[model samples]
Target: MGKLYVVGIGPGGLQHMTVRARQVIEESEVIVGYTKYIDFIAPLIENKEVFSTGMMKEEERCREALRLSKDKIVSIISTGDAGIYGMAGLVLELIENEQVEIVPGVTASSAAASILGAPIMHDSCNISLSDLMTPYELIKKRVEAAAQADFVITLYNPKSKGRPHYLKENIETIKKYRNGNTPVAVVKNALREGQEYEIFTLDSFDDSNVDMLSVVLIGNSQSFVKNGVFITPRGYKL
Candidate 1:
């Protein structure tokens, strides 16, 4: 039986991807992933067999990757850290006894945090606003808990056409625990093409600027903005 590698491409930029991730893709005989993720690594996978599927076809894609891995070295790719809201879990669940390796890469939260200065230097947690696989109530509970705990929070899949108000509602939930002046940062296409980011206060954040491609980071009570930089103090003595 051949081995399967789950690779994280890291925000769709070759520069952001790990060397191990690139090596696995280059060494694999077959590549499988979502259509957009496949396009991200198109340069490395030339002359290799690639299988791509669109959104919501994750099961089909994972199964195909497993099937091909039975006799061929297959690499399945996910955009930003395979283990974080990526294909690593699903692929692991579907495999019977296949040998698999998970290669970690920079996650969206890290990428966005870097662009927004030290907003996540203290304790932090990531929550997804997408309600497709998870119940909205559960997501809200997670958001509220994180906010109450004073953790710097990162919101993924923040807004889309169908669930436009979800992000705003969550922002209100956060406001209950955090002050209006709490620093908030929205990063779009982080570390990739057309990258853009803006810092705002919790109350002044404009949800209209966010979409599925954006990552929202909100600071804790102790966080502050100075010299155009968002920072959450890590209890340093300086």
Candidate 2:
């Protein structure tokens, strides 16, 4: 049986991807991923057979990768770390007994954090605002819990046209536990072409700037901004 590799391409840029991720994709005879992610690595896969599908076709893509991997070496790609809100879990769920290799890469949270200074230098948690696979109510509960606990929170899939109000609603929930002046950073297309970012306070953040391509980071009570850098101290004596 041929080996299957689930690789994370890291923020849609070749420079951000790990060397092992690039190596595995190069070794694979077949490449599979969402259309946009495939396009991110277009130069590397010119000679390899590529299979891609549009949004919301994750199951179909994973199944096709499994089928192809049964006889041919296949690399299934996801943006950022495959294990974090990516294809690694789905692929494992679909093929329980099969041996597969998971190659981790730079997740979006870290990529965005680097661009925004050290907003996650202390304890942190990630919560997705997307309710497609997860219920919104449950997502809210987690948001509240994380906010209440003073954990630096990184929100994934924060908003889209269809769910435009979700990010605003979560911001309100966080306000209950965090001060209005708490620092927040929104980074779009991090480490990729056309990247942009802005820092805001909890009460001043405009949800209009956020979309599926953005990663939102909210600081805890002790976080601060100085000279435009957002930072959360790790409790080191200085």
Candidate 3:
């Protein structure tokens, strides 16, 4: 049996992908991922057999990758770190015979933090507003608890055309514990094409541009904005 490499491509860009990930993909005989994700690394996968599925077909994709791994070294690709809402976990769950390796890559949260300054310098938590796999009520509780605990909240899958109001709901819940002045930063398509970074206060945030591709970083009570940079101090004397 051949090895199965789960690789994170990091926002679908060559510059952000780790060298190990690139090497694995190049050495693999087959590559598999979501159709759009595959397109992101299309330039590097010359002459390799590729399999792609549409959105919401994660299980099928994993199964296909595993099947391919039976005969060839296969790399299952994902955008951003595969362990965080990527294909790593699913592939692990379905792996029964293949030797698996994980190639980690940059996550959007870190990429966004780099662009927006140090908003996650201290305690922080990431929450996904999408309720496809998680229940909305449970997600809401997490939002409220993260806020009450004063954790720097990084939101993934903030909004989509199918679930347009989830981001607003999370912001409103954070307001219950945090004052409207809390610092908020939104980074869209971080390190990828058409990237955007904007800072706002809790009360002044414009949800018009937020979508599934955006990562929202909302600061805790000690967070602040200075000269267009959003920062959450680590409490060390400066």
Instruction: Tell me the lDDT of candidate 3.
Output: 0.92
Q: What are the clashing pairs of model 3?
A: none
For each candidate in the order shown, give its overall lDDT on alpha carbons. Answer: 0.93, 0.94, 0.92
For model 2, the superposed segments whose C-alpha errors exceed 4 Å read none
Candidates in order, TM-scores: namely: 0.98, 0.98, 0.97
Off by over 4 Å in 3: none
Off by over 4 Å in 1: none
Encode model 1's per-residue lDDT on 1-238: one tens digit a residue.
Answer: 6889999889998989999998999899999999988888889988999999999999999999999999999999999999999989999889899989999999999998888889989899999999999999999999999999999999999999999999999999999999999999999999999899999999899977899999999999999999999999999899
lDDT of 2 by residue, 1-238 (tens): 7878999999998998999999999999999999999999999999999999999999999998998888889999999999999999999999955558999999999999999899999999999998999999999999999999999999999998889899999999999999999999999999999899999999889877888999999999999999899999999899
lDDT (10s digit) by residue, model 3, range 93-132: 9889788999999988888998898999999999999899
Record all residue pairs in model 2 with backbone atoms less than 3 Å apart, i.e. clashing: none
What TM-score does candidate 2 reach? 0.98
> In angstroms, how far off is 22's CA in candidate 2?
0.5
